[model samples]
Target chain A: MANEVAADANEHGSGGGMPDPMHQFEIKRQVELDVFGIDASFTNSSLFMVIAAILISSFLIFSMRGRALVPGRMQSLAELSYEFIASMVRDNVGAAGQRYFPFIFTLFMFVLFCNMLGMVPYTFTVTSHIIVTFALASFIFLAVTVIAFARHGAGFLQYFVPKGVPALLLPLLVVIELISYLTRPISLSVRLFANMMAGHTMLKVFGSFVVGLGVLGGWAPLAFMVAFTGLEILVAFLQAYVFAILTCIYLHDALHMH
Target chain B: MPQLEIADFAPQLIWLAITFGSLYLVMARIALPRIGMVIEERRDRIASDLDQAEQLKQKTEEAIATYEQALAESRAKAHAIAQETREKISTELEAERMKLDRKLLDQTEAAEARIDAAKDDALSQIKDVAATTTEAIVTSLIGGKLTKRDVSAAVTKALSE
Candidate 1:
C-alpha cells in the first residue's frame, strides 16, 4: 500500500511512466501482527487467499444452495467444478482415491481460484509465491508419504526399486527413484509458481509495450496482450488441474505402491 | 520479491490453513454431496422416464395388435355368417325348385294319360258306329228277316275285310 501510494504520487510527477510489472506481486502489509518474531501479519496475500476461499465457498454454497435439478448458470458452474475434480481424482487414483475427493477438490479449487484471481490487474496471486505453493505441495507430499507407509509398511520402499531392473543396476535405479520421490514437492511447487510468475511477467511486459507505444502504434501489442491474456487464463486453469492430478498420482503411488 | 522472502512463510501458511480448512469443510460437508445428489437424481430420473416411455410405446403397439386381431376375427365371423346365409337361401331355393318341378311333372303326366284315354275311347266308339252303320245298310237292301248271328258275322267279315 505504501508503494502504491508512492506510485500514485509519482504518476502525477512522471506523466504516466510504466511501473515495474513484477511490482504487482509485492505483498503489502494490511494488518501487522508479530507473534514471537514470526511477523505473522495479514498481508495482501492473505487477504486474497481469504477472498479466494470466501468466493469459493459463497460461489458454491449460494449458487447451489437451492440445488436446482436443472441447474442455472452459476449452479451449473458449481456442478462443473465438482465433476471436474471428482473425475480427476477418480481417473488418477481410481476408486481408492474417492475418500480424498474433498481434499483434491479443495486443492484444485483453491489453486484455480488463486491463479485466476491473480489475473485481475492489481490482485495478488497467492499461488505465484513459492511459500504458498511449496506449503501446499509439501503438505500433500507428507500426507501421501504417511499414507504409503501406513498402508504398505516396509514394502512401500519397494516403490523405489523397479520390478524388472537387473540386480546390478537396482541400487543406482533406487537412488534415482528416491531422488525423484524426494523432489515431488519441489517440482510440484515450482511448476505452478514458475508458470504463474512467467505468465504474469509476460503479460506485464506485453502490457508495458502496449502502454509505452502510444495509442498510434500500441494496437499490435494491445491485440497481442488480448491474445496472451486468453492463453494465460487457460494456463491458470491448466496449472491448477496439473497440481490436483499430480497430487492424486502421488496419493495413488502411496496407496498402491506402484 | 516479498514472495521469496522467508519471513512471510508463516503468515501465508497460517492464512492458507485457516481459509482452505473452511473451504474443505464446506465442500465435504455441504457442497459436494448436494451436487452429487442432484446429478445422480437427474440421471436416475432420465433413465426412469426413458423406461416409462419405452413401456408406453410397447403397450400402444400391443393395443394396436389386439385391435387388429379383433378386427380380423370380426371380419372372419361376418364372412362365415354371409356364407351360411347364402348357403341356406340357396338350399331353400333348390328345394322349392324341386317341388315345383315335381308338381309340373305330375300335371304333365295326368294330361298325357287323359289324352291317351280319350284317343282309345274315340277309336272304340268309331268301330262300334261303323258296325252298326254296316248292319243297318245290309237290312235296308236285303229287306228280309235274317238271323242275328248271321248279320253279326256278316258285319264282322265286312269290317275285317
Candidate 2:
C-alpha cells in the first residue's frame, strides 16, 4: 500500500553530481531525537511540514486581519480559501457538517500547502510520503468508523448491505462494499502519494534527460518538463481537493449511513 | 529515496501530527472567527446604515410636507388680510364719497336760496322807484296837489298799462 520503492534511477546517474530524481523526497535529519526507542527526529521533511503549517496560518491570519468590507487581493485569497473549504464540506456533508469545518479546512490547507511547497525548487512534499498521507487517511478512516458506529449503532451495517437487493446478489454486494470500505485509507493515501511521487519523479527524469542531452537536443524534453510541471502544479491543487472532498464524503457516510 | 528507508517514517509522522494540529488550532481559534466576525460586522453596519438612511428620508419628507403646509396656510392668511383691507378701504371710500356728495348738495341749495332772496329784494326796490317816479312826474306836470291815494292809484294804473 505504501509506494516507498525508489524509482530506478541509478542507471541514469551518469550526469555526474546531478542529484537523483527521487533525492528531493528524502528525509535528512536536522534535529535528532529518540524517545524510548522511537526515532522522532526532526528532519528537513519536518522543517518543510512545519513551514507549510506556519505559512497556512500566517496567510489566513494576517491577510484577514484588516477584514475590509471590500476585500483586497490577499484578503480575497484568504476568504476564498475559507469559503472554498466551507462550501466543500457543506456540499458533500450537508448543513450538519458545519461543526467539522475547522478540521476539514485545516486538513485541506495543510495538504494544499504541502503539495504547493513541494513545487518550489527545494521544499519537501510531506503528503508525498506514505507515512504522512496514510497517517492522515487512517485517522479520517478511524474517526468516520467510530462516528458511524456511535451515531447509527449497529444500523451502520446497513450501509454495506444496501437496500432492496435480490437475495442471491446480497452477499456479493456486501462483500464488494466491505472491501471497498476497507480500502479507503489505502486508496486515499496512495492516490495523493502516487500523484505527487510520480509527478516529481517524472519532472526530475525529464530534467535529467534535458541536462544529459546538452543544449540543442534538450528542447523536446525541456518543453515536456515545462508542460509536466504545469500539470503537476494543477495536480498538486487537485489532489488536495480530492483528498479533502473524499474525507467529507466519508463523514457524510458516517452521519447518514446511506 | 529515503522515504523507502522506513526509518524516516517515525520522524515525518510525528512532525506532521504536531504541525497539522497546531495549524488546526490557529485556524479554529483565531483566523476563522476573526474573518467571520468582520464579515458579520460589515453586514450589520450596512443594515443599520440603511435603516438610518431610510428613517432620515422619511423624516425629511415629513418636514417638507409640514413646511409646505405651513407655507400654504400663511399664503391663504395673506390673501385673507389683503382681501379684508381692500374691502375696508372700498367701504370707507364709498362713505367719504357719500358725505362729500351731501355737502355739495347742501351748498348748492343754500346758494340757490340766497340768489332768490337777493332777486326779491331788487325787484321790490325797482317797483318802489317806479312808483315814486310816476308820482313825481305827474305832480310836476300838472302843478296841482294830488291825494296820496289817488296818486298811488293813478301810478298803479299807469304801471299796469
Candidate 3:
C-alpha cells in the first residue's frame, strides 16, 4: 500500500528527483504558512513516525481494554512489553527507580513499535535518521539530569567527582567523568541511527540487485536478500533493546551516581 | 549529484524535538498514572481477598471443634443414663425375689399344722376300736377257762394308756 501510494505520487507528478531510499530523509516544506518565522517540513519520515505513534497507542489501548486474566495474543504482547521494561528498569536502576516503571515501559514500547514499523517495505525508517535518534537520546539525557538535580539538589554536581580517588588523580578523573557525561547523548543517538540506517541501506542494495537480475540470474541476490532481511529484523529488535537499556543505565546513573 | 544541504537537516530536528517532547509529556502525565492505579488496585484487592479467606478458615475450624465437643458430651451423658437404669432394674428384681420367698415360708407352716391335727384324730379312733376287738376275743376264749376275764381286762387298760 505504501509503495503503491508513493508510486502513484511519482507517476502523477514530479517531486524534483527520482526516489532514492534516502530520499525519504529529505525535509520537504509542508505548510506555506510559517509560525514565528519558522517553517514546518512534514517530510515522509515525519509522516511515517506519526503513523507509528498512532499505531502504537491504538494497539496498546485496544489490546488492554478488556484486561482479561487469560490474555489473548495482543494482550500478551502488550503485557510482555510492559514486564520486559519493568524488569530491565528494576535490575539496572534498583528499587527506588521502580516508580518510573510506567515511563520506561512506554519508552520501550514506542521505540520498539517504531523500529518494527520501518521494516515494512516502502515505509520510512525514522530511526535511520540522526535527528530522530538524537531527539530521543536528548530527552533521556535531560530527564536524567533533571532527576539528578531534583533528588540530590547541590549533591548532583558530585557526579563529576570521583569516589576514593587519590588527590593526585582528581584532575584526571574529573576530566574523564565530564567527557563521559557529555558523550552519553552522542553515543546513544549514533548507536541506534547508524545501525538502523546501515542495515536498511544494505537491504535496499541487495533488493534492487535481486530485481535487476531478474528470474534466471536472481539466485545469488535472492539468497543475499533472505539473509539480509533476517539480519535487518534482528537489528531492528536489538536497536530498540539497546535504546531502552541505555535509558535504564542513564536513569541508574542519575539515581545512584556511583 | 547534488550534495545534501545543511538546511535539510534543520526541520527534521525541530519536528523530532516536538514529537519527542509530546510523547514524554503524554506518557508521564496520562498513561503512566492510569496504569499505575490499575496495578495498585489489583494488588490491594488480592491482599484483601487473602485476608478474608484466612479469617474464614479459622472460623470454620473453630466451628468444627465446637461441634465435636458437643458430640462428645452427648455421648458421655447417654452412657451415664444407661448405667443408672441398669442398676435400678437389678435392685428392683432382688427386692421382688425376697418378697416371694417370705410368702412361700408362711404357706408351708400353715399346711404342716393342719396335717398334725388330722393325724391325732385318726390315732384316737384306731385305739378305741382295737380295745373292743381284743376284749371280745379274750372273753370268749377265757370263758372256757376259769378267771380268763381278769387277764383280758388288764391287757385292755395297758393298751389304752
Candidate 2 chain A worst ten-residue window by lDDT: A1-10
What DockQ would candidate 3 receive versus the native complex? 0.18
* Alpha-carbon local distance difference test for all models: 0.88, 0.87, 0.74
TM-score of each: 0.86, 0.79, 0.78
Instruction: Output the better candidate (2/3) by TM-score.
Output: 2
Off by over 4 Å in 3: A1-33, A67-76, A98-102, A220-224, B1-5, B108-161
| Model 3 chain B worst lDDT run, 10 consecutive residues | B1-10
Candidate 3 residue B12 Cα shift, in angstroms, is: 2.2
DockQ for every model, please. Answer: 0.58, 0.54, 0.18
True contacts kept of 3: 0.26
Any idea how many clashes model 3 has? 0
Tens-digit lDDT track for model 3 on A46-95? 67667766776666677767666556887767666666777898899999
Arranged by TM-score with the best first, the candidates are 1, 2, 3
Off by over 4 Å in 2: A1-20, A64-76, A160-180, A256-258, B1-5, B112-161
Considering only N, C-alpha and C atoms within 3 Å, which residue pairs clash in candidate 1? none
- Model 2 lDDT tens row, A72-180: 9999898888889988998999988888899999999899999999999767788878888999999999999998998899989989997899999999999999999
lDDT of 2 at A1: 18
Candidate 3: Cα lDDT at A177: 92
